[model samples]
Target chain A: MATTVESPGIRREWQRFTPRQRLIRYAFYLVAVAALIQSINSVDIIPEFLEDAPAQIVDLFARMWPVDWAYYPKTVHAALIETLHIATLGTVLALIMAVPVALMVATNITRWPALRLLGKFILVSSRSVNSLVWALLFVAVFGPGGLAGTLAIAFRSVGFVGKLLAEALEEAHKGPVEALTATGAPWLSLMLKAYWPQVQPSFWSIALFRWDINIRESAVLGLVGAGGIGMALDDALNLLYWDQVALTLLTIFSVVIAAEIIVTYIRSKII
Target chain B: MSTAASQPVAATRQNPFPVNWGARLGWVALVAYSFYAASLFELTWERFVVGLDNGAKFIGRMLPPLLGKWDLLSKGLLESLEISIIATVIGVAVAMPIGLLAARNLMPAWVTWPTRGLIAMCRSFHPVIVAILFVKAVGFGALAGIMALIVASIGFIAKLFAEAIEEISLKQVEAVRATGAGFGNVLIMAVQPQVLARFIGFSTYQLDSNLRNSTMVGIVGGGGIGSTLFTAFQRFDYDFVLTILICIISMIMIGEIVSGWVRKAFQ
Candidate 1:
């Protein structure tokens, strides 16, 4: 259906492939696949319990079939709210903090190469570390709460927003900046009047996009006790409350979808 | 204020509705809710101070990260790298057909709907959540982590792949079709060349991301360095945890560099 062809002539033509062509195509795939299958069989990668995985998954789904709706109001609601809060607050804070870093990293803005390198290093390091790991570190530092989760989300977002923002900054129309600078505009005024204006639309979109991503990241931060629906999820999982777990997962899915819709709508409006 | 002398600059739009009211409302609501949320979370200055003290101590302990657990470290790293490579290969391979089917421009609604839905479901949950589910299903190990990452890899790349296919110039596909070529031949002759570079880029990026997530899945007992790091944390082996973190970060950075190189090389 992907192709426009409507007739069965394609299959008949497929069979007409020369033997040599077929052999060459099949041989490589066959060898690679055989090696993959053989390695799986040879390695201890598969555990004994894996044989029962299907059955266990079936059982697990059965247990989770009827989500505990009652759990939402009492347990999940607040944590879900906390997760949303973490995402929003984190994205906002990250955007604000990223402004300076973005400027420093943008070659057109920063004068010193060393400062640019420092900015790039900060972005790379932040981007490289997973939010969960940051949450783990923050949990140890802040004793596990929304603060830790919020901070984790913020720090993780810094690299992402900063990198994109810096690129946007560098790519901003130099025409305006050069025009303004020639008029003897100070650095701050020139940036505010020239650079900021150019990147505003993109910055808005990136901020929204980052918020959408942060929602996904913060949803899982609770697993490490950084506080959110995820911590509740961790608790439910630990207690084997499969019904509650199902409910939590559903909440997360809905929130993600909602955020996605929002981002789509905003980007459409802007662009 | 300074723009007053600029004689109504082009940046100053004449329309009263130039401001995006919806966005303004969004910002206001976000700020208001942040304050309310802060209160609910009890994010206090006093608590922050105490936390900072504890964090300082934690940092102090992490200064000289322990590198003594070479066996555990290398084993987990090797497993993670293996998991990443295998997952990327399998995920990209499987995603190709699904992506083709999911491209709304190429396929009928019925076909695209189910395929797109599948991609969405794959993407709905975070990798860690998926890892948790797989760990339970597969009874904990690198296999579970591998399976989770595969699903993640598929989810991450398939949507992009579908978009790439959708964006392909049908002019080329039509020209191939005009030659009375079979569908497969048309795909190879036209569609493949345009999309292959992008597919490679997405695949490499997925691999880089998978490497990071692979180290993380073990936190929930799915298997890898995360498990070791989690245990060190639980046992209050801050030094060891720090060491694992450094390793993980370095590995991720290396993957980032490699993937960047791959993308640049192709470009």
Candidate 2:
């Protein structure tokens, strides 16, 4: 089973590296270890921060005696609806924005290499940032509300969907596209007739997948004042209302699970 | 005039392909909607101009970053790094086994379904939300942060790694199993070799992600640099805030490099 394949020169050179090179690497590791040890020996200022925690924890949990069964009903109604709406809107918006750009970013689709590079650059920079960072930035601009949450979630979704779809497009079966092009079809026609159909399933599944993530993300955007159940959760925590916190956590967990199941069902049906 | 009239007939005869009217119309609609949406978002010239000035002022205030508070800075950095590393290790270790067990192509329905559900549950919340829950559950500080990130890590890495596993070549696996090898033996010899390089890639990527996330988990009082950075912002200590931001970016970039190196070495 040991089949002999020709070793490319670059790989051969890599395999022939000397021991001196290895020793230098070990020296670098030693320095890193020393610096790490110095950092660890630094005093824990964390104790000062935790000094007030005992009182806060006690006070926070004190009011949790009888569960707020009435408040639970309210949470189930309004807050649940808002979280779903935000996630749905964000998914719709991101899909709309991602499709065309994903086509442009796909290396095989875009005839002009420069355009593909620029599109990929835009996608990379956009996606490198996490959704929470985007939420914080939008909160500053849009002022704490659902709009900010929507924009933040949608912005990140664009990046996620775009990158994934672009990759799908890249990995598509080339035979159909080549055949279409050989028949003197226009570039757009080649893509529409060949590339789109092959990659569409993956794109659909990824979008459905994003929906599951977005629901959870939308729940927390409220913590940063972007508006949702998170705002309620934040308030409950600050005031040390464990019963309310418990209620919010329960709602989020169930909604997220339900959303996940629905998404799983949809992706299965679609793909 | 007669030649010009004849030219129209020649052009029509030469160019026989009919334009796709529906697609053209769709493109037009997309452009119009994008413009309308931009307007609705107030992404106007005036806003852009004012925003530039405001950003300049913010940058100006942050120009001279205060490194004088080395003690606090160093402590926070170390804590954040520890939180990230610990989370990455625990998260990846937990995720790898579960991810393998959850791969639809390899595992039975009963095992795959539950594992997939567990991953989805873990992944549902953003790290910050998870951190909030953990803080409430375990009490505040580094412990909460670690737990939150561990959950987040499991959710993300497991789902993706499982997908990677599921997408791998069944032919190669079948070839190994054809030699009358046991399931464990086949997985070790056949499955692991096919997926190991990619799994390493995923693990390193997760570590890099955990580093970035670790910085923010503290914003919810989970622990690390986020709480420190948040406090500095609230106090309008712009210089200190800038310093922290710079340090975070640098640390993340370094983490990215380290992750890359790890992947290269393992591969």
Candidate 3:
């Protein structure tokens, strides 16, 4: 029944479907494509309206090439270092804050409905707001620098690390925890002896992963004056220094790629 | 010799997370760097006190968020919606084919390598950076934001799609081929069914992401609520900034809820 080859001479495989099924499929695709086209048209990005777009883009790139390689020693190097510092410090701060929050949010650990709800709320609200907005807020308050950037990254990461680690804590095997409780281990001791071991891999993975992301984030936080390589890039663009912009971008690209490679290597070795 | 061998086993039982030299040294260096950077940034208690005073004033002004700028707010919101929807739709459509082409299980190295490289380039920069590039390319407005997000969407969804396709069981594909089915028949009968659910899940998630990203792109003159929000901040219009923040947060939370429902319905 599965192999329904009709003729030996034919190379084509035809599906025998009812007319209604074919009609429905066609109508479904037609509707989907039509809606998509409508939205595209609504955005009004048609090339016809911007006849010189290609030329402008070509000119922009032509201007950007032959990057100001000399810009590195003056500013790019210091900016790159600050960006890495922001990511590293932020990740550590987030991890310190997230541990207790993760425990409170995990259903198996917290047990109290109200506490869990509060923890979940913190996680959701933190994750919901983009880091740029957080950076903006901190910039307004702190008047812009690497401190604001670090705090923004930390706040943004708390939710991510907490949420994932909470899931990890909840999924841990119950047998060890129960055994520790039966033996009258203190709450701290029980967690240390039982939960910590099981959730260690997940906790570290989330921490490292967030650090990698923070690297990318802190790179651009300077656009809002949070202080990083992004500030340099933003300034260069503002001044219409396309060559400097090109150099800044290239530096950012290499830094991000290097971070990726480092994280991958560490993860492989550890995980 | 036997006692020495047993000594290491006893030590293993004492720690839940054993500290290797690499991790131990990593920790020491991280702590050292933290203090170094803190000093470099000149973090002082006196400075913090001044910052706190400013923060209090900012918060005081932010209360009772003003909603008087309905004209600008609604216009920006509508444009952001259009940008996200159009970007998501177009990005997902383009991604589907590219994703399939990039599937290592289905494609030759020559095809997968270049397609994967393109996706990587798309993802390397944050959306705001890409938006800046596109704004410079296409000129400022929703059009540039939409274009940047399409590239962002393609980068994200295509990679996940390719991974999903790679993970599917190939037995069904083999069986279809054994029946002398054409390549299209095999794909339709075997490959499509396996990956369709996951594809939908990725698409919904991408839309949710695009919506949040659309707001921020406007800050770089890429057209969205972000531009208004940026202006409000620059002018120190704390109440308006508060209102914009509330609107953005609510939209994101609603997106989260909607995507959750989408996943449930599809599952």
After TM-score superposition, what is the CA distance of residue A132 in candidate 3 from its true location, in Å? 0.7
Clashing pairs in 1: A222-A231
Docking class of 1: acceptable
Writing each residue's lDDT as its tens digit, candidate 2 over B1-267 gives 587596876554544345779868966985776555455445568866665676577678877998888788877877888887677777888999999989999899999999988997787677887787667656678877887889988998999889988888999888988899999898898888788778778877887888888888888998888888778866768789778877887888788887787666655
Candidate 2 C-alpha lDDT tens digits along A1-271? 2344456653322333367655654664574456445434542335544565567556646756455656666654566666666676777788888888898988777889888888777676566666766676666555567667777888888878999998999999989988888899997788777887798799779878898889988898877777778877777778877788777877888888888789889887877
Ranking by lDDT: 3, 1, 2
lDDT of 1 by residue, B1-267 (tens): 557557657556576325778878987997887777777768789987998899889999887888697998988887777777777788898889999999988789999999988999898889999999988898878888888998998888989999999999999999999999998998899899899779879988898888899899988887878888888888889999888888888888888887786676555
List DockQ, one per candidate, in order. 0.39, 0.16, 0.44
On the 0 to 100 scale, the lDDT of residue B128 in model 2 is 86
Question: On a 0 to 100 scale, what is the lDDT of residue B173 in model 1?
Answer: 93
- TM accuracy, model 2: 0.70
lDDT (10s digit) by residue, model 3, range A1-271: 5555766787545675567666755665575578567666666465652676788799889989889999989998998899988898889888988899999999888899999999998988889888999999989988889999988999999999999999999999999999999989999988988998899898888988998889988888999999989999999999999999999998988888888888899899878
Between prediction 1 and prediction 2, which has the larger TM-score? 1
Candidate 3 residues B133-208, lDDT tens each?
8888888888889989999999999999999999989999999999999989988999999998798789889988
Lowest-sum lDDT 10-residue window in model 1 chain B? B10-19
Per-candidate alpha-carbon RMSD to the true structure? 7.1, 7.5, 5.5
Q: Could you tell me how far off, in angstroms, the CA of residue A1 lies in candidate 3 after the best superposition?
A: 11
- Position A157, candidate 3: lDDT: 92
Candidate 2 chain B: minimum summed lDDT over ten consecutive residues — where?
A: B9-18
